[model samples]
Target: MAIQKEQIRTALAHVLHPEKKVDIIALNMIQDIIVQDKYVSFTLEMPIKNDPLTQELSQRCERAIHKFIDQDAIVDIQIGINVSQQRQTPAPEPMGSPLSGVQNIIAVASGKGGVGKSTVAVNIAAALARNGAKVGLMDADIYGPSIPTMFDLFERPNVTVQKKLIPLVKYGIKLVSMGFLVDVNQAMVWRGPMVTSAIKQFMNDVEWGELDFMILDMPPGTGDIQLTIVQSVPLSGAVIVSTPQNVALDDVRKGVSMFQKVNVPVLGIIENMAYFSPPDAPDKKYYIFGQEGASRLADELAVPVLGEIPLGQPIRESGDNGKPIVLDNESPAAASFLACSANMQQQLAIRAATMPKDLSISFTEKSPSAHT
Candidate 1:
């Protein structure tokens, strides 16, 4: 059977975009259709770079050609990301909030606890600071505040004449946390409204003046506290943190869903404690928590895996000593944290069209993971 351009178009017309619910031909997604000796090749125009649907849609087009056009035709599909024809309007934010001056506000969250989400949040903030970006770290985990002990801040926040609370500065990053307000020995015994009130105060009552990035260290779990915080603040995007374990990856789905339901773009995922490496044998890796669990999940979700941080003693020591691991700049763990932070911003550049372009500007060299 002789293949024609019109016949190829007819076959592709049967392929529909899952999200837009429109056939590729009507959407103008198929182009450069060339037919030679039954070898069919064409460019598949995707709506955005790194779209999760890129693979599935490309496969569908290939199958459509084989099943509908010619069973023996050879299919070669290439993907090209297209700038949206119509730019989406930015979502309206809460009026009169102090976050107006912040360039980008992102959340570091997890589906379940004990995934080292706070450690990742604190170190990412430190990496940004090391690159000379003005950064702010907020302990959104009202019940289990870790920023105070992580940063070793114990001084009570001072009030401005306007009655706004002044955020404390350490290591060139502004920080605020419930840990600073309550006694070190006491547990935060409060209701949902009280927790929401404290978070609102952190956003509205605190004086976090002009920052390049405001990183929220969100509490673990996808529950009422998490929902309340997301509703209370204008988050630019979110980063899901999980260990390379199936149990943790299960919760990661819930966390990602919560953000997606609220219209927040999930920038990427960070696979924490992916493996363990010994100082004596740097080349050897031990898969202590399972192998490539988060990577598989990211592939299924169609999001980028920003980094894979190895489990190590330095990370724990730095947290216990009130200094994040990235402060040591000479260590391998610092390099990993810095790279993860950079790749995350790269997603903010490519996936998040609603963010300011300046938010994607990299202070350091490009990240290795951004290639994905």
Candidate 2:
């Protein structure tokens, strides 16, 4: 006997939102249920995009569906933010007044944690620096500042005589991170306002002089911190990083949607840890997390897959040792990062060329007092 959509819905009815105390089907959160043979796919609407409950609910619903259907059946769940009731105003203009000297500002973000987002941010910045572009990497992951350990930078930034904070320099890349200001063991149990203020200071009070590119390593998820950073900067574009896993790819969609809602151009998606390749056997590839998951998601979202970074020991070792893999010219991971950076540069150029003159001018024009 074939499974029916109604039966799947009944199975999902057994699962309830912990807080809402209502089944997802009863709350009208499930939509477009498509059942084909042993396959089932549907969209799960999230009331809060970054709420941790979303993941939990997704897992519960998946388990419920499998209870009535074949255990080995492929169940696909897409998460969509329910913002139909929200106002449809255009995103604010780039906050370029305080950062007039920066030629471009790129944000590296992930929909979920543990996706190697910071690693990608650091390497991309390092690759851009190696290419002779003056680069700055701002570790905006205030709660979990790994940039300090990643770059082996432990000293606090020096305050200039003019009261501006001087960004620490390493590998020709100027860097700022919350890790530098706070103790390594301290937790940043801060609220939204505090996070917003800290990011503002990183931009306005830091002496990031003459940077061609400022790469922001945004914290995971679509939350207040992410919202503040994007709203307060004149971003050139955003690049999303995700491992090739269904769970990660689901969050990637939310991340993409967040950027699109804010009117920020999504440059591309980079599939980090796309596959594993052993050093001894260079020709063999291992899809430990599921092959091309991110690429498939990118295709569905109509974005380009900038690059596929393989999982390797050297990449992890380099980060732990405070050296980015992109600095190691001979490593395959380094080559991948460099190629991704080059693709990003090309995308920026294309965006500039295609954008209207007025819009382009807004991002590039320096304020008269900015030089003084």
Candidate 3:
């Protein structure tokens, strides 16, 4: 019988990836298979480039084709790397002239609550400010604004002579939060529209003057309010925060999907509460959650794992004291946050260099309006 494509594919299915432990066909690595008279050509989309197993996989595929085809037939196998692309959707409406001067606006998000999303946002902003970048931190978590407590600032934002609300300053970073507008004890029992409106007002009414970067402490979950805020602003990118646990990583995938749907590039993932190490025995490491969960997720998503922050008492104390651990040079958490900040800055710089100047700041369809 003449050679058939299905027979060749069945043979190739026996070839498995050594690390992923799955057949190459099941992994969807095989693409663009073509069969002509006495000739066969196919492409292998590898996840990693220059992998040590590339040669082995190539030989295996050639052998598989030889088994089904005539002895004199030519079999051509092309090996190439495949990069994953984010899901695409229609871009959001153009944001008005609220954040014209801000070079980049980054949202720090999580799929669920209590993943240290706000803490990561605070420390990253503080680290950038320390590095001499003009930074602003806006608490977009209207229901649970923690920036006020994180920065230990209770003073209400002042209305300027021009009728604009001025963002409070702490740790050399401009800040705004619902905690500053309402009593800390009161619950924000507002609906979706109200919450979205408040976030819009925070973006437009607040006079955030000349910021190099704005770190938005986003609320947890992928709800309407989250969609509204993201749609209302021209976010440069987003960073997802999650613990080193399967549960947290599952939610993280949803968060990443939401940003991808909105056409916002995911900067990377931050693994918080990654591990624990006693001060007396710093060399010893303990994985309280699963080991390398976030790192594996990042790899799957084709994004970088910015940093793995260890769980420590000093981090909790600094948060409660309204002083982020990044400001405390003596703490180990400070070093971790600094490293994360550096990685984030490098990513931002690379993005800026590659993107067209006009496309760098905003991702809306309409032309940006003049600053009002």
Candidate 4:
């Protein structure tokens, strides 16, 4: 049988506070109790920050749960104290920006995988760099990092004198990937907290100085990593990539809605795999996935159709060769990514022009919720 909240609560109730001579339940030190199959997690809420008894009580709770409840129960007790005071702390003076030197942080995201999201991201980064904009591409897809393979970057990022990670430079674009830090052959077996922590380290600890744009190749979906990015960084905007098919467009809608809910502006949509053209004909376009489905959806949403990328062999080969197709001036596929980059730049320009002067980009500081 799966673990129940009440059963775990009953076990935690057995642990008494040594200083207060009362159970944690009576002291109301527990909040946000969660239970799953054999996994249990709860917040060990305390009244003050860094209480000396915090660690002691946490261990006791673990022991009590094992002794009184399921011996095999996996427990994750997180400390969350000083709620009232932390909430009331004044916002620190303009710390510049969370990602200090990066001018624009754009996440290239898709609702589902296999829609060629990363391809679009890498090429977009390359195109932006080709135009002489200082660009950085962060492979935020922790579960299935492809930037290392896509950019042919095999070495780990060097650490600076200040202990910040020095992102490897590739073809003039700075790059970072989870693939570089771990054994490449080993599969990442990580949970939500672990994934979030690793991503936070990528954003906070990397030496990304004075970038014109930081392109984040987000994991396919609106999950923990996406949420953490939106909450942690002041994203200038997001570009939704989708195939020209209803199934992919359906998730694209969800992705759009998720960004809307978080106040991150959806820049526009790039219809990848919008069509396939024969190398021999060079002009014959086949609507294998359906025609302009993403563009129609973009029309419905009143957003711009950035550009349509056709499926091509050279594009794939370029990724395999550790070079973006955009570097090839003759490849038609590269033309598509460059056009998309231009449209994206135009959208960013529009957003900048209409910005409220009083508008603080740090709108996501504590959170959109904290403001409410």
Candidate 5:
């Protein structure tokens, strides 16, 4: 017989919590259990703050539940501690603007910097917009915002009637950059909290219209900024960009692992500066940056290699001139970006159908009025 929540609960009703010496299920430590087609995923509510048995309980639950179902059935388990009533009081929903418009939020990240991560971000956003999808690009690299330069916009964003700042738009792609807000000659030497607040403001205070995708050019490396963004934003997916070199590929693994750590599905990897194809002899290709490091990394990591962007003068020239190569729509670099965007869209659709749904936990579907 297939496993059911009732059966699992009944079985677990005998499993005692080491600290409380009470049945875990009966203690209400089990928050939600969901069984989908051939898949099982659930969240465990922990009562003790800083419970040391959280991981143990999660593993035991998974193992115990799988015994009733097929061994091959997939299980995703999340462990969370229940806070006190006073601590859990609902936060007031931001009144003026919520991130209600953007459909998909994608982070364009790199293991290390100088991998053309920002270039890939801008071109991909441009390509998606060109393909009839409304898009927004947020330069989350607080220390080094490049989206403003890529879009060729130097004007500071202005406040709207709603008091939210209107983001700059160019080539049909909306943009918000830390660079535009700060002096280039100065450095962003703020601490973690300061950077997080700025990123939050960029996300919540900007008037980004209904967008199909919001591409975040994340700061290189797995650090506090990365974790803050991952926790705060409901990211649809992530794309790692790297060049065809061992050093670059080494960092790519770290980048991918960070996303996997948080259960964020990686869309794919893009290999920038894959090769150089001379314009004169279009057929001849040169492996300027070694060979297929990204392809090798993807194969070993079991992720898709979205596309390989060649070393094109137009790509760099377009950046310096504030126009993405993808805007040209005729160059090979532009074609590669368009292909990557298409592939990413397809991957996102597949993920949406398979990923577990968010659990909305509360007393009632609607809250009671204060007067009541």
Candidate 6:
């Protein structure tokens, strides 16, 4: 028999929401259900905005449908917030939020940690800023907020008028991170809800003025944290970062699949540490992790390969010094980042020109349930 909507719903009902401690179907969370010939789609309405459990809920739904149907079947799930009618009072606006300043908030993410994802995010923002585009960097990796370190901002963030927090400025880029306010040693113990709350506060309370790009330095892996951040902001698209090694490539597929299931348009893939070139031997390139794993992955997924960043000491030193290699016009690493920025701009232009217009989740405060 072909897969039925009731069959998928029944299976989902068996998988309880881990945090809510209730079956997803019973909680009135599954708002709509539809099944095509070989495609299954549903929307899981969350009770709270940026709910950490929603990410887990998405995976369970995917698993249940895949188990009963074909493993290759297409599953589309969107996480939305259910409107609460009981509350009489309205919620106040959020501060230091990325959606406030940028039209398109793109998260640079990875499947597994330690793939130099933050470095790519920071440099990408720097390259974009240097090109006369206003940019902001939000260090959304709550437990491991590295944007402050990347920008070399040791000073604490201050509150602005309207009682919102102002982002730190460096090399013409505005930035915010938990590293500036919390004790670095204590953040690791934060629970799921605490992390989600912090991300909300960052987005709602921060004063990010006008920006062309607000790059979120997302946490690694397809975990609760990643999902929470995705649900918290209105993202223009997602850029997956990965190395060319086999293990990293395997996890990259999972990361890509997560975005696909959620219907987030993947901008492209950025292969960091693509190769290593000695400072002295600029002409020589060594393939430290093999060749073009990310490019091949892009081919398989039918997304563009944005660019590959070669591994080099200057790239590391520049990041450590709070200066992006892109600022050093003569360096090859700097040139590569500039090229990548141009490629990204071209891709955006192409999308705007060729793609049909549709209503995506809005970043405006009016649509609180929209995905960032």
TM-score (C-alpha) between model 4 and the true structure: 0.70
Off by over 4 Å in 5: 1-96, 358-372
- Candidate 2 clashes between residue pairs 3 or more apart in a chain or in different chains: none
For each candidate, the alpha-carbon lDDT, in order, equals 0.82, 0.80, 0.80, 0.79, 0.77, 0.76
TM-score of candidate 1 on Cα atoms, chains taken together? 0.72
Query: On residues 85-184, what C-alpha lDDT tens digit does candidate 5 reach at each position?
Result: 2211112335445567777889999988888999999989988989899999999888888887787889988999978889888998888988888875
- What candidate 6 gets wrong by more than 4 Å, as runs, is 1-100, 354-372
lDDT of 4: 0.79
The candidate, 1 or 2, that scores higher on TM-score is 1
Q: Could you give the candidate ranking by lDDT, starting with the highest?
A: 1, 2, 3, 4, 5, 6
TM-score of every candidate relative to the true structure: 0.72, 0.70, 0.71, 0.70, 0.72, 0.70
Per-residue alpha-carbon lDDT of model 2 for 1-372, expressed as tens digits?
Answer: 788989888888888867756667766677788899888877776655554776777788778876766787777777766643221122232565446568888999989998999999999999999989999999889889889999988998899898889999999999999899987456467888888888999988998877888999999998767877787766778999988879888998999988877667788999998888888888688989888787778789988889989998888898899999999978889999998999888887766544322111011221222110
| Tens digits of per-residue lDDT for model 1, 1-372 | 689999999999899878667688766677778899889988776666666887788888988998998888888776655653221212433555687668778899999998999999999999999999999999998889999889988899999999999999999999999888887345467778888898899988999877888999998899988987986777778899998878899999999999876657788899999888899997788999888788888989887899989899989989989998999967888889999999988887665532321121112222222211
**TM-score between candidate 3 and the true structure:** 0.71
Model 2 TM-score is: 0.70
Off by over 4 Å in 1: 1-97, 184-187, 354-372
Worst 10 residues of 2 by lDDT: 357-366
Give residue 51's error in model 1 in angstroms.
26
Give the runs in model 4 whose Cα sits over 4 Å from its true position: 1-98, 184-187, 357-372
Alpha-carbon shift of residue 243 in model 2 (angstroms): 0.5
Least accurate stretch of 10 residues (summed lDDT) in model 4?
A: 363-372
The per-residue C-alpha lDDT of model 5 at residue 362 equals: 23
* lDDT for position 2 in model 4: 77
